[model samples]
Target: MRFLSPDFNFWIWLQHLDTPDNNLNIPFEFTEANMRQVKEILSHYPSNYKQSAVIALLDLAQQQHGGWLPVAAMNKIAQILGVPNIRVYEVATFYSMFNRQKVGKYHFLVCGTTPCMLRGARDIEQALLEHLKVKRNEVTKDALFSVGEMECMGCCVNAPMIAVADYTKGAEGFTYNYYEDLTPKRVVEIVEMLRRGETPPVGPQDSSRIRSGPSGGNTTLLSDPKPPPFRDLASC
Candidate 1:
């Protein structure tokens, strides 16, 4: 994920990693249930192509590890998949979705594509950063929130949206919720709701919208159209 800072250099930052406490010290292994899941994931691939399951396994590992992939977790995934450690590390680091370091309980990924940008995504992002008192990708002192940027999330119709990944409940309760049709103020309200342990309704936040519909209401197809004429073979 790209940070908000203009001077941010991902490559340079990659060289000097600031990881979570005991990230490498603690051993990581899938739970009994997750181990069963690993078998299921492997089932989809041919025996010799177990490496193909690297991405899926890494995602599972992230979920199991509470939203980030620790070094030990990546190592464990490599062992499970029987691939080189670099295989898993490469996949994990390449994907923006996989977090290398620890994130907060709630990680907000704001879409900054053309649609969202034209609809004031930057303002929404700034509002979140300001309210949380943290820079993009920086976790709050309380470890409750962090902000990051993402590409189009396919919710452009409801532009200026933020996808909040809630790790508060851990793997089972983990939820990736999208809040669409946002304003700076509305986004903050959603954050406040989350902070208070309240589950704000997901999807289009605007009162007038019903999940990306026209702002006020449907303006077209107000009346039924005439039925099409059917040609009979007998007449021909």
Candidate 2:
């Protein structure tokens, strides 16, 4: 269930320095258009509380920087928000959603909490890693895919689920889609679809089911219920 260990901070720091795809040495600033968006985001908060937009700005920065936030990008966000650099770093590190290092163009986050685990989440993870020929958090040689583990994504009814973040189309075309109720074979087929630049349908993989409804069709509420009883308050 735990994706990060106690030494995660140290590991992430090392990655910042050593990861070739993430050039931490380079400077990062918001684009002119992104800056305009930043201004719009800041507008939602009072001028005195611009710092409250830290998380939102960090997300924008990540999107602009190709799906991960480098040290430079975090620093730039701190500067823009007028807060200490550590504040931005804290937010980024605390949230699993923020990737400190580089990820593949298609990053798969498999839910591994109790519900998902009991439903074959581990198998899904293994299938993805094996088929992609990459370990958890490691990008494939083609830079098209990577796999990671996540806690419950609130789709327990669907159980075994994955959330895919597609960065192939850049920030403007970025998409985060969820695929739920999967078997090992089905999940791998979804990956192959991505490899072929095809978008597999999102949500439950089982054709017989819809959304999180019962797999064998509704067992209850098959017919409309009688109208609610009404009291004559005026007469009383």
Question: Tens digit of lDDT per residue, candidate 2, span 1-236?
Answer: 34454454337533456455556568898999999999999999998899999999988988887788888898888888888999988888888888887788898999979988888888898898788887688778888888876778889998789999998887789898999889999999999898898889998899887767876888999799989999989999
Candidates in order, TM-scores: namely 0.80, 0.82
Q: Could you tell me the lDDT of residue 133 within candidate 1? A: 90
Query: How far is each candidate from the true structure, as Cα RMSD in Å?
Result: 5.5, 5.8
lDDT against true structure, model 1: 0.83
Please write out the lDDT profile of model 1 over residues 52-120, one tens digit for every residue: 999888888888887888788888988988888998888876787888766788999999888899889
> Which residue pairs clash within candidate 2?
none
TM-score of 2: 0.82
- How many residue pairs clash in all the candidates, one count each? 0, 0
Clashing pairs in 1: none
